[model samples]
Target chain A: MTEMPATEMPATRFPKEIAPWDVIELTIPVRTDLVVLARLTAATLASRVGFDVEEIEDLRLAVEELCLSLVRNGDDGRLRLRYTREGDDGIAIACTFEAAPGRGLRELPVDDLSIRILDALVDEHGRSSEGGHKRAWLRKRRSRTVA
Target chain B: MEQAFDISEREGTAAPVVSVSGEIDVATAPSLRNRLQARVAGGDTTVVVDLAHVSFLDSTALGVLVGALKRCREAGGDLRLVITEPRILKVFEITGLTEVFSIHPTVDEALEAPPR
Candidate 1:
């Protein structure tokens, strides 16, 4: 078979390169003692994206609140956290249970205190399920600086 | 006193333990708040909060501390803190309260430190 001309040939394009620290994944036990790990990681990523001090704190608390909610309702499971950068303005932290094979995500218990605290702490907060994994997410935007 | 946590004051001193030394999260923050509120309302401003024994605190705890700090400042005094645990101090650092509150390694230093 004769090859097509270069103009008629299809070119392969690689996927876009992900920025450094654009995406981070952490897996830890679903234990109360380990919630601090999530909080510190969230705060560090938020700071890297230029979030102000107060915003960093807000994200830190939001992550802590969410993680505690998961740990309280869970038992001896593993938690998977995905930190994805949202443009250059902020960060989004998504949490899910790393359940065993053939297992469904447990019902996460969100107390009144957690609800009220999260409402006051994060820019966006909610839960979602994709494929099979269930995820709870909270997003925080970098505070705009005064001129 | 053996419930979620305990709140006590040093004898013969106007300073109340705004610290509420325990895991001061949503479950225990109210106790700390009530103690701080009572002290400030009782005319005990510029209190010494010894959180050195505390290992964990959340935003609710932070809010309670902030509220107490505001009330103290309005009364022409301030809220000083004694925090030795790095984990506990990290909460204040991340929240930017490290700059707002006068933090010391010891209660005596916190008590003796000048107010902002």
Candidate 2:
């Protein structure tokens, strides 16, 4: 994978090696009413990936926060989400938002309480920007005992 | 779009009980906040919020709860919560709010507790 700008560090990078089994992608209008669709999708995918009840709930909340951030900061463009499962127990989610013209990919406010909540739920998270779009990504590894 | 959120309030023996079910996110948190604020504004010092039926809760909802707690305390009242779902409980634990709010297993217990 190509290196993204240091300021936009985490969103563009992928795992060094990944053998994904299933991939799910969605693009929805940037509206508050549509945020639940993303949350439900994350929960369903996390559960299908054999995540325990707690992990599934965590993923659901994390995805909601990501979508909320995009809707709060994004232009009137649609938001895109991609969920990928690697091997058997690893799940990764990437959310990309289209920036309004003249407004480059601005960083999602890190100091916000929502970001803090997302940090506590996911194992790892990062954000990056390229062209006029920005992406935020989160990764979680299913518990060995459960999966 | 139809909202997946609902809030119902009933008069309890000690205080007003607000039962919230369904998803609480950015779009619906304001409703919850307004309900809680009204309870505080009504001179009810002790309020119990039942979240056992809430299927989903996000950080925005959490922030609203925290804000309500502060408002209640400032007005010489306090807000208590009744939560039993592990998923909802985990959000409190992750945010260290488990210690901030007076959490009870049931609305009855929350109402029985002494006001702060």
Candidate 3:
């Protein structure tokens, strides 16, 4: 695997209100092999928060898509993922990266099939950029009853 | 880096069958694409992808499959899939690709199906 640089961001970058039980944060090198680590982390969190089998699968795929999108657009950066359990039955995931010089997040292909897949699997999603860093947020609400 | 996935091909009863077993994601997608492209380039019109052993499927991998299918059809051949894992199948369903590709429960079923 190609050696990619990774930096650990200070926890202060996140909201101060993050409860230990509700938040799981990971910083992984922006390598394809490690994308599975992010996906499995998201799945485990979602499952713990009461997401059904199907919903957990959806979250897994959505997280993987998010990572792939960032890796494709950003030439070099560590992937920072934050998963938070919403009140009772919802999960929200945030992914962000400080892209390499000349490789900003604006070039990400938002209209591609991968984005469409993310949209279909998640309840809501949004993107934003500031200071050369880009972030994608996805939220999924667990069904009250599993079929 | 060595690819995390592998693709092996064999002659089926009626078409060429490729069995892929591993997680298909960004890192491994290019390898899958190259193998499928080579098979299509070799003039095997009909191809069946056996994905029962695939533990994970991402959009990049799905895009590779879609691209391969398009190439095969343009060459007057087709691509079919044998998928049984519901987790992997859910990815196809969410993308609405279940309707786009001919999916069967087994490789034998895919090879025995009437030609498209």
Q: Which stretches in model 2 have alpha-carbon errors above 4 Å?
A: A1-21, A73-75, A100-108, A145-147, B1-4
Q: What's the best-to-worst order under lDDT?
A: 3, 2, 1
lDDT of 1 by residue, A17-110 (tens): 5577599999987655577688779978888888887777678778877675554433567789989877767677778766666656666545
Docking quality level of the chain pair in candidate 1: incorrect
Chain B of candidate 2 achieves a TM-score of 0.92
- Each prediction's DockQ? 0.08, 0.65, 0.68
CAPRI quality of model 3: medium
Residue B14, candidate 2: how far off, in angstroms? 1.3
Worst lDDT 10-window in candidate 2 chain B? B1-10
Query: Distance (Å) between predicted and true CA of B36, model 1?
Result: 15
- Candidate 1: stretches off by over 4 Å: A1-20, A100-105, A130-132, B1-56, B59-116
Model 3 chain A: lowest-lDDT 10 consecutive positions: A1-10
lDDT of 2 by residue, A44-85 (tens): 888887998888888988888777665563357778998887
Q: What is the TM-score of chain A alone in each candidate?
A: 0.76, 0.78, 0.78
Give the distance in Å from residue A3's predicted Cα in candidate 2 to where it truly belongs. 22
Query: Candidate 3 on B1-116: residue-level lDDT in tens?
Result: 21346778897468888999878888888888998999999988889999998988888898899999999999998899999998888788877889899999999899888867
Off by over 4 Å in 3: A1-18, A101-106, A145-147, B1-5
Query: Which candidate do you rate higher for DockQ, 1 or 3?
Result: 3
Index of the highest-lDDT prediction: 3
Best by TM-score: 3
